[model samples]
Target: MNHFFRKPILLITATLFSGSIINAQNVGIGTATPQLGKLEVKGSTGAVSAIFYDQSTGVAIENNHPGIGFNSYYNGGRKAIAPGFGGLLGMDPASGKLHIYTAPASIATAGAPMLLTERMSILANGNVGIGIAAPTAKLDVAGNLKIADGTQGEGKILTSDELGNASWQSGASLVPGASIGYGTWGDCATNGNIGAYQPLTGAAGVNNFGKSVSLSGNYAIVGAPFETVGSNYSQGTASIYRLDGNGWVLMQKLTDATGAAYEHFGSSVAISGQYAHCSYCRRPRRKWRAWFCNHLSIQWQHLAAAKNYANQPCKPGFLWQ
Candidate 1:
């Protein structure tokens, strides 16, 4: 009687275990039916689908490659999973580095539809690489980089203002044929003659012409300090030119009526409405003279003259009145 009861109990337990396996068929964590995968979890819109956590210790799931991964069907088809169709975030088992991988949209094998290509990688040393497999620096890029600010173009320069704001601006270039011819007063008056009728024979860079320049309205004054007068060298002079409809035209040449060599009479010049000023500084004695310019006749007249007292030791001055 005991043997008969034991056999029935053991047979009943085996039957119940078999039924439990059949009932547990495809397990769905959040859904009634598990889809193509063995385990399926569905999430609400805008919320995380699933989270894997370990309550025993702080360390969660760890694997050589991706411990958990995902896949989707291709072209909205439900028959088969897409080939090379997803992204994976994982850590290297050896180096302990995090890596982001993606698969191309091409079919390779049904078992392994696509090969995982590392798109971005962060090494254990904290170096990152984009489009580069291995990065040796904090940030490394293997492709071209472009910077745009909406108003930048070729032949422009990046400039910064006083407040440290940066922008692009036009670069400097030469104006097309905008040259102004200038020379010594004696050279223009008598066809380059320095003395009684001697032709000017000075070479380029020898005469310090254009030492001073001033502009007023449509008139411009240029100075030549190394001009020769009679038999003296460096008897400075200034020339005034007017801008007509044609261009810059020679107007008049100005010099001290009683200027001597080494005076540098036109070392500095300034021009205003109808007046012009020129300075002559020769150690121990500084002379400043004002001239009244007649634009109509293109003539210059010495208006007033002042001489600095050597003992006064005043500032190197100019006469404007």
Candidate 2:
């Protein structure tokens, strides 16, 4: 008899459970008639709409929600609304801080569903990241940022004004022959020959002076690769000049100690600090060499001299200063 009564009670419990499942519909937490969604929570002015708590893990999870959660508070008789702001809200189990994420929206169609893009999250450590999953700094952006002010140009720099506003400003000029207001004004062909000085003796076409020139500090070097020395033709020479007061005075003339005919000694010239470098390219013997000069001690030293092998082609060599 006891077993027969227990069987009837089990059948009644199963019938009542199935009925509850069939009658399940939209649930309204604080409203009489909820919206078309599965669940809806409504609040009054100056009041929080909902608060979820999970005592098991100390983290709350809200899924498939629309609109911002904590932005509906009244402020100074004004209601500021943030539209289309919805995401997941959770609490970090370790730090107990809130984490908010903006959820991606979607649109349903007959063929496919299109998802709308949105920002990811604000981390529990207060770091915000855009276009990145993990941010290592305070505000980390993984993409390029372009400032679209009308005053900016190609090579201009971004600068801040006294009012703390940032704008673009012109950078420093870096072009050669830029006049910066510190030179005497006169034409090259008609300068009154104020401080002009040339070789004491040279014919019209033989003197190829000022072919190569280098200036550093107060020193200048000029090369003449076709200047004749004694009876030799094209025995090149170099001249060093110093800036004395407002004029350039010739300090010394440099020539190879064992200079021969057709050796273009001063084809290239460079100066740095108190030293000068000159090159000699001997075309006939296929030989190339460079010499170093110390302007302070008035000493010359042969640094490199190399002769190409017979029947071997050669290219122009470079000398480092």
Best by TM-score: 2
lDDT of each residue in 1-321, candidate 1, tens digit only: 455444444444333221111255765665666664666655421222443333211111223343333342122121113343555567777886787766666543333444556788898889999878789999898888565888777765565532346666544344477554345654533432222221222324445667678988556777776787666577777787755433456767787777777777667788876677777754335444333444444467777766654444324444221
RMSD of 2: 19.4
**What is each predicted model's overall lDDT from 0 to 1?**
0.56, 0.55
Compute each candidate's TM-score over C-alphas.
0.33, 0.35
Residue-level lDDT tens digits of model 2 in 252-283: 88888777887767778988767787887665
Global Cα lDDT for candidate 1? 0.56
Q: Tell me the spans in candidate 2 whose CA falls farther than 4 Å from its real position.
A: 1-186, 189-205, 297-321
After the best TM-score superposition of candidate 1, give how far the Cα of residue 3 lies from its true spot, in angstroms. Answer: 99
Kindly give the stretch of ten consecutive residues in candidate 2 with the minimal lDDT sum: 55-64
Query: Candidate 2, TM-score vs. the true structure?
Result: 0.35
* Residue 67's lDDT in candidate 2: 27
